[model samples]
Target: MEFRGRQTQKCPRCGGKALINQYKCPDCGLIFAKLDMATNKAASQRYKNREKSAIVFVKKVPIDLKRWKLILYTVLFGLFGAQYFYTKRWWWGLCYILGFTLLSVCVIFNAPLLNIWDGGLISFFGLIVGVYGVCWMFDIFKVCLGKFKIPVSLPKNELNAVILSKEED
Candidate 1:
């Protein structure tokens, strides 16, 4: 009956196939008329070539109360750590030293996939919950030890100013 091939021709005026090979409506004299893809595979293939997708990357994620507390403590400890290193305070560095010491000890002392739990996720939650519990107790101890000094002498408003001063130092 007829021949079919790749999209090889285009119209000059509208740049569409209507004026090139196919019949344009005699009454309208239109150059670009849409065709049903069900009968014309070549036309549908042209659209498929233009389709594309895009992706994006994000940095932060939502964390729970315990994780939030850990994040806060870690930030505070890290700031103290830097301060201690600068001011030559051995006591402030004790936690970082002890933490690394225990980590090295753990690496040196492995028991081939150690299993202390009774085959459940309890062991996973246990560490996080345990750390949170310890932090709670530590908070209580600090509250008992002294009038809950707000981490530093500078007020919330003065933190930026204090930071600027430290930057000058």
Candidate 2:
């Protein structure tokens, strides 16, 4: 008795074992030869470089911010960009704070130069404030949904491990 269809190794792309002559994965149409030792070595080298870069970046991120805390700050002080400040994005935080303050001042003082522009400056500032408010609301929503992540170098699980290690010390 002769066996007709012998099983082979699983496909790396789709995990299918239906390989054709140990060259191509029939199930996923992935050519195994495309991933030779040279390709794998190059890929491994790139990954190591990226990992090293990420380690350096994670080391620089002083505060590992929590999602809930970011949401809370976004909700409480979004107008003043408190969340950005916590994320170490000083430029964005300062811009938001300054923009809000300037707009408020413009609206409250009703300056003489603004009046000379026939309320144009007030209207322009109002539009800016409205746009900023919408953006702030979206930011709050994104933070609550865990979409607005901090730009750390390591993966989430590894980053958490690092944070735990730091706390233990």
Candidate 3:
């Protein structure tokens, strides 16, 4: 009896009295379902446009490292943060490089000097090396398991679109 809370009970498009289950106008063959379909189609088209734009934007920004390549680099050179360098994390890469370099130099050059301190210097060196090895192995696992992601700054909508496009591929 009531359509969309309106008391008139007339088709809004043609002002016809024909109403089928409060959703159709038989005179004009217009249905509320068709309107919903049209709305959905329009929304789909808009999403497609956004996806296209996002793809174009992604093209402009170069992602130098591939997932497999990153994993390989991590396995081979993660102790020196080569993966971080490839991912454009300059600060982390620098820290890893410096840490590994300094630790290696200390272990190599201090071996003779540490002999005077008996096992104290050996234990310290072993601890540092163990920590570094553990970190390197963790990084390798993270990269190989696809848990590591390259950080990129993108607008929210564009980022969604880009992620969607990547998933499609």
Off by over 4 Å in 2: 1-63, 111-114, 154-169
**Among these predicted structures, which one has the highest TM-score?**
2
Ranking by TM-score: 2, 3, 1
TM-score of each: 0.22, 0.51, 0.50
Model 3 spans with C-alpha error above 4 angstroms: 1-64, 155-169
Q: Candidate 3: what lDDT?
A: 0.56
List candidate 1 segments past 4 Å from native.
1-83, 112-169
**Residue lDDT tens for model 1, 16-84:** 343235544232333222221011122123224431111101111111112244344444544233322
- Model 1's alpha-carbon lDDT is 0.32
lDDT of 2 by residue, 1-169 (tens): 1225765665544566753466665665555443321122232243456643222111111234555677779999988999777765567789899779977777676777476889887888888888888878887887777656343333332221222232222
For each candidate in the order shown, give its overall lDDT on alpha carbons.
Answer: 0.32, 0.57, 0.56
By lDDT, the best candidate is 2
Cα displacement (angstroms), candidate 1, residue 72, comes to 19
Q: Record all residue pairs in model 3 with backbone atoms less than 3 Å apart, i.e. clashing.
A: none
lDDT against true structure, model 2:
0.57
Q: Between 1 and 2, whose lDDT is larger?
A: 2
